[model samples]
Target: MATMSSICAPMISVLPRRPMIVAAFQQYCSRRTFRRTLQVRSCSSATSHVAPLRRLANYHPNIWTDEHVQSLTSTSKVQREEERERINVLKEQTRNLIREKQQVAEQLQLIDHLQQLGVAYHFKDEIADVLSRLHASLDHVRWELKDDLHATALLFRLLRAKGFSVSQDLFETFRDEKGNFEARCENPIRGLLSLYEASYYEKEGESVLKEAMDFATEQLKALMEEGSVPEAGGLREQVAHALQIPLNWRLERVHHRWFIEACSGDNTIDPLLLEFAKHDFNLVQDMYKSELKELSKWWSELGLSEKLPFFRDRLFENYLWAVGFTYEPDNWRCRLNETKAICFITLIDDIYDVYGTLDELQIFTDVVNRWDLTAMDKLPEYMRLCFFALFNFVHDEGYRVMKEKGLDIVPDLKRTWGDLWTADFEEAKWFHHDQTPKLEEYLENAWVSISGPTILVNAYCMGKDLTGEALKSFPSYYQITRFSSRLFRLIDDMGTSTDELERGDVAKCIQCYMHEKGVSEEVARSEIRELIKKHWRALNASLSWDSPFQEYFKNIVVNVPRTAYFFYQDGDGYGKPDGETKSQIISIVFEPIQI
Candidate 1:
């Protein structure tokens, strides 16, 4: 295990020495006269006398400026050292508590808190050992939890979430002969909430869990309507939040502060545990600020926002999205590189959807497929700059891998970019032709167009546990990647399709479904929501299979969709960040937990 200092030290040493070409680009961007002239020239190619009529989305300017981001700083040295020492002490103490004997309910509750508090990564071995022991003593554990819906559901969820083969039939103990959950199970509210959350882990054909979900959902909503729950602590608030989005579906880091504050108010939790969680969260947040500062400088220096001003300038949101994928402290490199990939994805997505003419898009796609520097001459000035940035990013990553692991991943990286551009070009063709594709036809391309595979491929390369075997086995993870990408596309379409359609973009999944089925928009949206749920089940099921991918890589793959839900659950959170998205970014990235 690397210390936080060691994990962060590389950034300080490596970021300042950028390649000379990037510095020249930055110098060009710094010149206002040259930038304006280049922007005008790039909008209209030399081959055409007329400037193409571009469809601009008119995205909102980013609220987090480079000055603000760079101004963010960490705590004093004395305070940092104290917190580190205190965290180390609490970590060992927490491990001892996990090892201590307790009731099944108590032990499961502790594990749940550790996970929600975002400190469970420190005790994975201990948690696994405890779960293994509990799994082996099923008869006794069942006897103890047979009457306790909360414990039974928690055990079922935690087990299933960790890839244990626990049966959903365990929930059958709470149901009556009429196939309805008994009224007695509804009093505790916690039990109903637990059951509600646990049902989200259900795979296909699990009718019992589905029934449990529906019943618990109805009961919880009724309770909320009647205002019958006690408001003493955060239980009522937690119940309300869970009703909006189940715990299983949430990105933990996005909601970490809420959970931490909720736990702070709970009298049943240990003081030491709560204290440790606060310090740990703040410490990690400090690391995030450092990474953001470096990334802000890098993005500012790259000059994309200034050079190509039509696209969305969402560096802050991109970093937030990367954090959603993997928030552990040691994986800062993954977060940084993933943010870069997301930025390019956003940039290229806009080029194809909003700016590029059909002919230019075809040429761009062909150039990407060629994956050669010689092809750079065919693109417009703006596109040439974009391609050069992407080319540098891919090879830089490839060079790092080659230097570290003696593996050349440039071909794999280029292939992902090629697939993404190809998909984008297909969509551009559809929009250009005023074509509404069949739902199936649209989805076949929309998944790749969503950029999940590109992001996951880059994540696998930057992440630890990479191997020659894993590189060869990359194609075999298609089921996981496809499921995740399909979910991202469906969820994104559900949230952003209206805005996208109104702005003269291609028809998204919802519109395709409506056109194909001849249904109302409401019906189309509801059906798309069902599709999201279906793919989620498939994604969960894929994780349970024996795959050649490492568990870390699998988590990153699944988290792609999870992060999408975070951004798009309300509506185009990434595109329009003034609402909940802004608040979440302020809370998770900027604001530290009060100690």
Candidate 2:
């Protein structure tokens, strides 16, 4: 705890701040304001006293039709097997390419293309070998490759990603006599973008990298204004993309989709890697299609879409999110498990928030806490089905965990459900009473309500190779989960608060801060943004060897917060992803890139 505070505290002061286009959603939902958006289904505001619910469309029904789910396609069994064989062939071909001892820049650029095109995950050992060799030569390359921004920037990125202790001093060569970035006015976009992207990997106290961020960001923004210039259109596009989401913060799958499309016109990209990337992506997309179909079928069977009339039925968004968390085709089973669990969580969240009355909410919470069928009889009509659904899902999950990990997961599952409901009940209490707790008070419950801990704990249950010892070591109390959960809450509240406030609900960080400080919303948001960075800094610090969790689990935990950024960045993409989120879904799962 002391280490966490110390790590977060210093880094909170590390960097200064900088600054959604969800139009398709607005057009589809057709609500003038998102506050009244999902007024669908009978699952309107549950406060009871908030009479005459906001005049809006029925906010919740299965938006996708049977045809939609049926139409989602994967190649046939023989085709996928063939595809796998082709992938192995391409994998070896790419391996030979990475194995070749070409010029230093040539090899680095090949590695870069492999990574940017998203095929790099297939070449991890080879990539690691190359980077390890390069790192050993770093001191020598320092003097030789100094002032070569493009190569140096790529090296920093590759080394840092491979876990090498890269120095920020690699960028010092780009500074002028005044210790300012050289500004490469004649032509600096590529170097600037590379440096800008690398700056994101700097650890705390690296003020030089922070300055590079400022320099690169400013330059990128100015260049982005030039808009598709003949010489720099691609550069402008790349800069704009980097400026939007730093390389570290970028969601891995989404980055590949964007990078592949961006590279289409560039002649310098290696054709083999690009071609392999498209096939690999399409092959993966086939897996995603199969998984989504399974989830869609499970959702259809659960009958929550029909029984729980007003709850948000976001199956597509739920699976899309699960993809961000675990996208490798090898983990399709885990992805499906995660998708189903989150769908349950999302359904239960809405049931607690928008459907159940305050009295019904309390009873449902108690029933879930009890974790028994006998308790189901205590529930009201609407609550009965939800309680039954949740119990069945968790019991099945417990069985799965016991079968695989030899762990009695029921206790942990009960704990997560109990905690999630307690958090839900607290928010309902606050909303009904119109009380805005102190920001800290609100955030304490908000993080739990955001439900990262519960779902991640569930993830621990469903994940492979998690033994009881690892389970005890995890215990849902780790700093990584706590920090990322907090980030998820803060980000969610910032994006969804306006609508939530309109509907009359719990006070979020933004509202709590505004109420506590009597500040403007914009100012509160800016400060909240800074607090998010502090949390990410803490989250990052928690991932070192000092942490008890395994490295693979650590990587998964990191994506918890990144998932929030992706869905919430453009106006509740999870809730109404028809706009920008729609485009992302198409690129990630539906559409195949033409080689």
Task: Estimate TM-scores for all models.
Answer: 0.90, 0.85
Write the residue-wise lDDT of candidate 1 on 1-595 in tens digits: 0111121111111112223233322332234243234435655653577776566789888888999998887898899999999999999999888878488988998998898888998987788888878888877898788888988888988888777788888877787788889534334798988899899988988898888889989999999999987776678988998999988778779777888887577765778788889999999989999999999999999999999998999988999889999999878889999999999999999999888877788898888889777988888899999999999999998998899989878888888888888788878776655566778778878888898888888888887668888888777777788888888889888889767765667778876666666666777789888988888888767766334247678777777878888989888999999889889888887888888
Per-model lDDT: 0.81, 0.71
The alpha-carbon root-mean-square deviation between model 2 and the true structure, to one decimal in Å, is: 6.9
Tens digits of per-residue lDDT, candidate 2, 478-557, equal 67788878988887887777765554455578766766666667788899998887786666556543222364566567
Worst 10 residues of 2 by lDDT: 9-18
Root-mean-square deviation of every model = 10.8, 6.9
Model 1 quality (TM-score) = 0.90
Scored by lDDT, the top model is: 1
Residue clash pairs of candidate 1: none
Against the true structure, candidate 2 reaches a TM-score of 0.85
